[model samples]
Target: MARAHRREALLAAVLTGALTALALWRVQPGGSGYPVPETPEVCLRQFREAILQGDPERIRNLLSEEMHPHQDRLVREQQPRLTQTLSWVIVQTRQSGQSALVLVHEMHRDGWIYPVEYELLYREPAWQISRISYLPPEKASIAPGTHVREAPWGQELSAPPEPSRTEGPDPEDTP
Candidate 1:
């Protein structure tokens, strides 16, 4: 019975020690608890943080050279939330080998969630941002009483606002 008690105490002590180590790992100044952002998901987390803080330089660093031209575009798009306090959330992250797609949503102060997807590639040193795609608003379906006034791709025509019942009085009715 004494031998069994000693074995149990040893087992408990080992488990407690392991848990303690894990718990304190991240607290260490230079700990390896969380590795450097090597994976796409990890890189994306950093990118999202940069976006939330409006750190254009950080965001640019995360992007690939080919995406440098788009830096201004991204900064411009995020300008709306600069004035208001906003929170960003990563909805989902999908990765395969060196490529990944991270779905993010920025919650506006007015409670609107705008979804954006980040395409990433694991470059030599780390994963880099390839592109950021914003989801477009859903098109309205043509219902019995509904009207399809808006055109695709946000284009506006100068023709007219009113809906016409006949298209030039039909082709056969022309004299």
Candidate 2:
């Protein structure tokens, strides 16, 4: 009877150990989390590395099919330009739920800096890129006293003259 009881206790302990290990494994980052990054920082780091390395294949896999073509074109078109004229650096990442927006700074060869924003969408159990947009740098407008004359093929030449202020709002504004 004692021997049988000992055997039963050993079996129970083995079962409990197995169950605990299984639970722990399921709760691990990638095991349960879809497209887990190990950590959020890792995700952003990987993104920057992918860009600097010019690995479009890795980038493409991270985007939806609809978004893939656009990024592919961007890499194909911009990479040469990027290699020649700019260096990309990730400035920051803003993440909400599974989506993230990565802000990148492009340091131009001429010492100009431009900010570009990348919209990342996480879906289908993975993180995929959705859209990318360029944000132009701010510049001061011409001074009020500065002479600004329109030349041929300029804004004034291409567009018809606007009605005088006395004429009131345009037709499009009426709606």
Backbone clash count for every predicted candidate, in the order shown: 0, 0
User: Candidate 1 local accuracy as lDDT?
Assistant: 0.68
Candidate 1 residue runs with Cα over 4 Å from true position: 1-36, 52-56, 82-85, 137-175
Colliding residue pairs in candidate 1: none
Clashing pairs in 2: none
lDDT of 2 by residue, 1-175 (tens): 9999999999999999999976665222234322344434455455455666886666555555787657757677556546644456778889898778888776665555667787776664556667778888533233223355722234444567785676778778897
> Can you write out model 1's per-residue Cα lDDT over 11-61, one digit (the tens) per residue?
999999999987765421123233346777777777666776777666766
TM-score of each: 0.51, 0.47
Cα RMSD (Å) between model 2 and the true structure?
15.9
* Candidate 2 global TM-score: 0.47
